[model samples]
Target: MSQTITQETQTPTVPAAHEAPPRGGKLAGRVAFVTGGTRGIGAAISQALARQGATVASGYAGKTERAQDFLHDLQSAWAGHETEFSIHQGNIGNPEDCRRTIAEVIEKHGRLDILVNNAGITRDRVVSKMSDDDWQQVIDVNLSGAFYLSQAALKHMLERGTGRIVNVSSVIGEMGNIGQANYAASKAGLFGLTKTLAREAAFQLARDGKLDDDTIGVTVNAVTPGYVLTEMVQGVPDKVLDKIKGNIPVHRLARPSEIARVVHFLCADESGFITGQVWGVNGGQDM
Candidate 1:
């Protein structure tokens, strides 16, 4: 008789529950820290992680009241998980604040498993009209702040032998936009940082023989969103919004939930082998 590959003959034993869908997206019993997570896409990301059974700490740069409100809302949304959600106020643009914020989250949660560098600002102006302050402010908050916080969080993550870092970049970083030189540069810098850190973390894990360990390995990645319907975009004129919408293949702006889902995926164990990658969650927008 000839050996043939048949479903019945080749099938391997599977657990009873394996036939059903997964209970969660492989992120149960994890802790996540999201910077600039009080509103917009950041807030959505926080909620998504909490829903997946992860303790989340959201960092806010200002408006303590709003941050507290966001925390309360998330706590209610994931009430069954005993989800621990809190807000830490600090300017990520400042290195000292970044260090203190990371320390605070680790102290409160006992560990830091995920770090999302989502805090950013935009000072849009033409080169001829832009002031030095406008250029520096955007760079300081968007690019430099990501570096500071990542460095601080990496200290704990590296010690623990595992973590996830997700940097929020912009599509403009790849396809430069008019009147957004500063914003563009900062976002572009994040792309470089994401790749470099991913390599370094992978190297460390390999050296320690932890590269194959699922429970104790780090992955770094970036998510570049295109034309998200956030406070920043609300400032644009209706005509401008229409023009931008026309340029997008999807003919619409990305919902915060959409971007959050991708971030949550990267933070999950299922994405262990995916690092040093930039997942662009643009609504079919080029670049």
Candidate 2:
């Protein structure tokens, strides 16, 4: 005769009230620097990060009045909170300027937790018709500018052992379009830069004995947005704009805030596990 065996299931363990993490924005006490943060997609990103309790340093290459106005609006939107915000003027295409802006932000905020390379420009023309200036200008600002800022910011981040770098690319970079050779190349270059930096950051952390399962190491990632409804896009002819919308599977342009949501998600503390990834906020356009 064999005895019957009984097994009891064990309930999952839960942390005590005192051990649970506090309920609030994950980025509280963090500082973020956003290039081209005065308008369009960049402005949306600045607001998103701010909403998450991050102190924002918005970098602009425009008039002081515009930057001041943006700051006022941002503060007004988040009234009642002792919001800490600032604006930095610099030409992203200039390496020295990039370094200076990063230094300024760190000096003011005591730390830099996030860097968003959102400033970019376009000199649209067919490859045959495009002048050297047109090509060089786009590459300098769109691609080289990102590299400059990242290089400067990474030093602080690696030393701190935690940070997030988010590069704002474009759908055109993934899928080439007519009369946008320069733009396409610059955006596509971000993919390579993002992946390489991610690897380097991890390697350095491990070399410095800072790598561990519990540690959230620095991360670098790229975001590619498709057909956002911005000032430039709105300037297109009605027929052309309609054709563009028709081509998109979503049949509508993306709002700036939608793209910002993805960027904010990547910048969160919980997103440490993700790195060197190319996130497409294109509404099913590039899948």
lDDT of 1 by residue, 1-287 (tens): 10110001011111122212223646777889888777777877777787677888988877777677766666555555566788899988788999999999999989999999988877777899999999998899899989998898887888888899999988888887778889889888999999999999888778877666546478899998887765455556777778878888989888777888899999987788889899998887863
Instruction: Give the clashing residue pairs of candidate 1, or none.
Output: none
Q: Output the TM-score of candidate 1.
A: 0.88
Model 1's number of clashes is 0
Q: If scored against the real structure, what TM-score would every candidate get?
A: 0.88, 0.90
Across residues 134-198, which tens digit of lDDT does each residue of candidate 2 receive?
99998999999999999999999999999999999888889877788998899999999999999
lDDT of 2 at 78: 61
- Model 2 CA deviation exceeding 4 Å by range: 1-24
CA lDDT, every model vs. true structure: 0.78, 0.82
Which candidate number maximizes lDDT?
2
Single out the weakest 10-residue window by summed lDDT for candidate 2: 1-10
lDDT assessment of candidate 1: 0.78
- After aligning candidate 1 to the native by TM-score, how far in Å is the CA of 209 from where it should be? 2.7
